[model samples]
Target: MIKFDKVTKRYPGGHEALRSVTFEIAKGELVYITGHSGAGKSTLLKLIAAIERPTTGTVLLNNQNIGTLRRAALPYIRRNFGMIFQDHKLLYDRSAFDNVALPLAIDGVAGREAGKRVRAALDKVGLLNREKAMPIALSGGEQQRLAIARAIVSRPAVLVADEPTGNLDSNYAHDIMALFRSFNEVGVTVLVATHDAGNAEGRLLHLDHGALTEGVPA
Candidate 1:
């Protein structure tokens, strides 16, 4: 339920991150964004999530122009999305459970219910028993999964990941993709930006020099 129409994103220094990009992602669909470095994959994802505004054209989320939304409306719109960054943004000082619980806490969800969801999310990522473990002690793959658990704990309808498997080996990457597929099966719209789009199930969108070069636009 997201659409971009001739959207161009230009940074402050006049660097165009995305050049007249156009695409749509339907609800409950899994879409892979494939490109080389500097191909604007990350910029596309940020635009979809409204973390970056389009310099021209429009970014529509469920028919609403999210790119031009007022600052006051941004937070509310963002709550519908779960974002996974390239670097696992976990707090080293906190336990895995705490990292996953942060979002629920910010939303004022009650403790009992929040605990249940946190555990369920951790379980989905196969990190249930490592709930109390610190990030420093976890392996790279485990850390990435922990980041995922935190993202899905809030149960947002859409998930946007920017290179979620960038750091892992082939096996770990496959497992991570499998997790994303499971989420998609349950009706979560997933957009993953990766270098290796490898026979991924869903629409594939390729970018080149900030332009859409191949793949169908949803």
Candidate 2:
């Protein structure tokens, strides 16, 4: 679970990215963060991931204040989160299998175990047949699925996606959302940040000028 208590983030130039934002995401819930450009959606996600610290207030992940966690503890803390981004962030030089296996490798998992998990993740994304395909050879949707495979290969507890469907056509976007819904059904907490209102599902949280708005879906 993630909780933000009166969080505020201010840059050095006197610009505030988020102002007194407060919300809680319960475990096993799927929530969408919706807002326009520069509305602080990304900043909120970053705070939960501990990529950025709040200038005021607290960001709690499973009851621990992540903002006060030591740098040495960050990687361990982040191990619980699977982060996806709009660009897919695939390694063009690597095949889909290798890309998905990277996280396990980084964690020093044995080759056999890593291979099993990698295949399982790819299977979940319906990309097992393309395991050997290079990223550039795949279509946009496949690449995004490959990214999802990579993100989940580690079996993280929380899945955080930023504009995950932004680059795809409506069909692919819906397909991706369905995948996230499936994951949520199986107990993976899912949080998505997107500008597209149609992408909102489950609990919807809206932001305007860095502030949580009354438009939040009931």
Candidate 3:
């Protein structure tokens, strides 16, 4: 349940990343946002995640306008969605379990419950045995799965992935897509921004110059 209405994002230098973009995603739907580099895919995800405020119009999550959320209340809004990035964004000093537990820890979840959920999430990504492994010790695919575990451990209503398969080989990339599909089937709304056409096999939405292409359902 995410909606972008006439949204436009312009940087301080007056470079427009998105122009009058409008879209809506219903609950439990898995959609892909795809385009070439510099095509505003990341900009759109950032706006939805509230990492960047729009220059104009609205971004709504479950009927709440994210653009209107106060800075102090932003974390509460963010708690409703999970996000993954191209880099995996793992902590070099932390173990896989620690990384997956970060979100719950931030929300003040105590030891036992956090541990339970963290273990479940890592297992979902097939990394339960690697819980004690540092990010550097894991392969590229394993690190990416760990990142996925971290994102979904909180059980957020929506999952936003920005090039989650960017660094991996084709096999690993397909594995990541299958993981997303499995998550979506279990009822999480999945919005993925990708450049790989192979990943666009299901429910594709193409974007260009910050605008979604025709026939692309949000």
Candidate 4:
């Protein structure tokens, strides 16, 4: 589980991305962070994933204060999270198999074991047949799915997606949401930062001007 207590993040430029935000997300829950552009959704995700530390207050991951962690311990703490960006940060030149294999490769997982997980992840995203396909050869939805596959290839306890459906059509968006729900059903804690919930079946926390405008901590 993750918990934030009076957290605030201010950039060096004096821009406050999050101000006094507090929320608790339980294990195995699917949660959506909804808001307009510049609503601090991405910042919140980054903080939760420990990509960025809080400027003030505390961010606790299972009662461990993330902001106070030592530099060497950061990577170990981050292993609990799998992050999906809005840009679908896939390698343009790498094959689909290689793209999904990056995380396992970084973790020094052996080739045989990594290959099995990579294939399983691709199959989960309905791209098993496209293992050899390049990013340019796939559709927009396919690329997003590929990005998702890469994120989940490590099978982290928490899944954080930023605007996972922002660029897809309604049908594609719905399919992506269903995919997320499927993961949640099997007990992966999923947190999707989206502007539109679009019939999302989960707890929704809305952000406004860097503050928690709605939704209580679950």
Candidate 5:
């Protein structure tokens, strides 16, 4: 569902974030992107999401050339993918349900249907009972799970998580991965970028200096 053909990215300061990277991810495949700090994993994801355009070569999503997408069409491109981040960028003032409902609302989902979908997503992430809680009131793990719920609330075809376990304890980290695994089992493509290399069992794609090494099978 995603492909990078000799893609390269260079920052304004001449730092090469990705160098002629090429890889293909089939539909419904779950993959891990592992690398040290500044190894270009985030750069790659940004390119795929069209937050950052490739300096050279091409990035394709569902066979569409993302590198050439018009600015007006960026949001449409992003609608097909869900993104999770380490910081769990929740709005402290909003309830968990409202937070997850934001995307659906943006897509024109009605009040009634939005509530139903948001609740279902929260339940999937095991946060059903806490839907009315504020972000600051939830535990760190709960906050993260709420973020995951928000990401998947729109039923995106692909989910991209960056350092999702960066702040959690081992137990919560395991729980988060388990949730991701469950999502993948139901056919949402999952690509996770993490520094922690514990006992993860997905296909591993290691990056170094913006180049992708071959994937390691678990």
Candidate 6:
């Protein structure tokens, strides 16, 4: 569902984040991108999400060239992706329910329907009871779970997570990975960028010095 053809992203200062990275991720496949810091993992994800345009080559999503997408079309392209971050990125002042509902609200989903979807997402992340609680009130694991809920609330076709388990303990990390596995089983294309090698399973893509290396089997 996503393909990168000779993709290279160079910053204004001539720092290339990705160099001729070519890969194709089929629909419903779960993949992990692993590398040390500065390996260009985040840049790869941003390219797919259209947050950063490739300096050279093309990025295709569902057969559409994203690199050439106009600014007005970016939001439509991004709606297909749900992104999670290591920082949680939750609105600390909003309730967990509201946080999860933000995407739906942006998409113009009605109150009753958004509530149903928000509650379902919270339940999937095992945070149903904390819907009214602020982000600061939750534990680290719970906060991460909340982020997961928010990401999946819109039922995105692809899920992109960057260092999702970075801030959590081993148990929490395991739980988070398991949650991702469950979503993949349900046919959501998942691409996770993590430095934690232990989480490298399924199809593994490695990066080194901005270049794409060989992929490892599960």
Query: lDDT per prediction?
Result: 0.90, 0.89, 0.88, 0.93, 0.89, 0.90
Residue-level error in angstroms, candidate 4, position 127: 0.3
Candidate 3 residue-wise lDDT, 95-155, digit = tens: 9999999999998886899999999999999999999999999999999999999999999
lDDT of 6 by residue, 1-218 (tens): 89898999999999999999999999999999988989999999999988888999999998999878888999988889999976879998899999999999888997788999999999999999999999999998999899999899999999999989888888888988999999999999999998876745688889998998867222
lDDT of 5 at 108: 89
lDDT per residue as tens, model 1, 1-218? 99999999999999998989888878998999999989999999888887888999899999999766898898778778898998877899999999999989877886799999999999999999999899999999999999999889899999999999997999999999999999999999999999888768888899998999886454
Rank ordering of all candidates by TM-score, starting from the highest: 4, 1, 6, 5, 3, 2
Per-residue lDDT over 1-218 for candidate 5, one digit per residue giving the tens place of the 0 to 100 score = 89988999999999999999888899899999988878998898888777788999999988889878898898989988888876778989899989999889888897788889999999999999999999999999999999999999999999999899998999999989999999999999999998766688888889987888756222
Error of 3 at 48 (Å): 1.2
Which ten residues in a row are the worst by lDDT in model 4?
Answer: 209-218
Clash count for candidate 2 is 0
Best by lDDT: 4
**TM-scores for the candidates:** 0.97, 0.95, 0.95, 0.97, 0.96, 0.96
Instruction: lDDT for model 5, please.
Output: 0.89
Clashing pairs in 1: none
Candidate 3: where is the Cα deviation over 4 Å? 199-201, 216-218
Off by over 4 Å in 1: 216-218
Looking at model 4, residue 138 earns an lDDT score of 97
TM-score of 1: 0.97
All-Cα superposition RMSD per candidate: 1.2, 1.7, 1.5, 1.1, 1.9, 1.8
Residues 11-42 of candidate 4 have per-residue lDDT tens digits of: 99999999999999899999999999999999
Question: What is the Cα-based lDDT of residue 175 in candidate 3?
Answer: 88
Candidate 3 least-lDDT 10 residues: 196-205
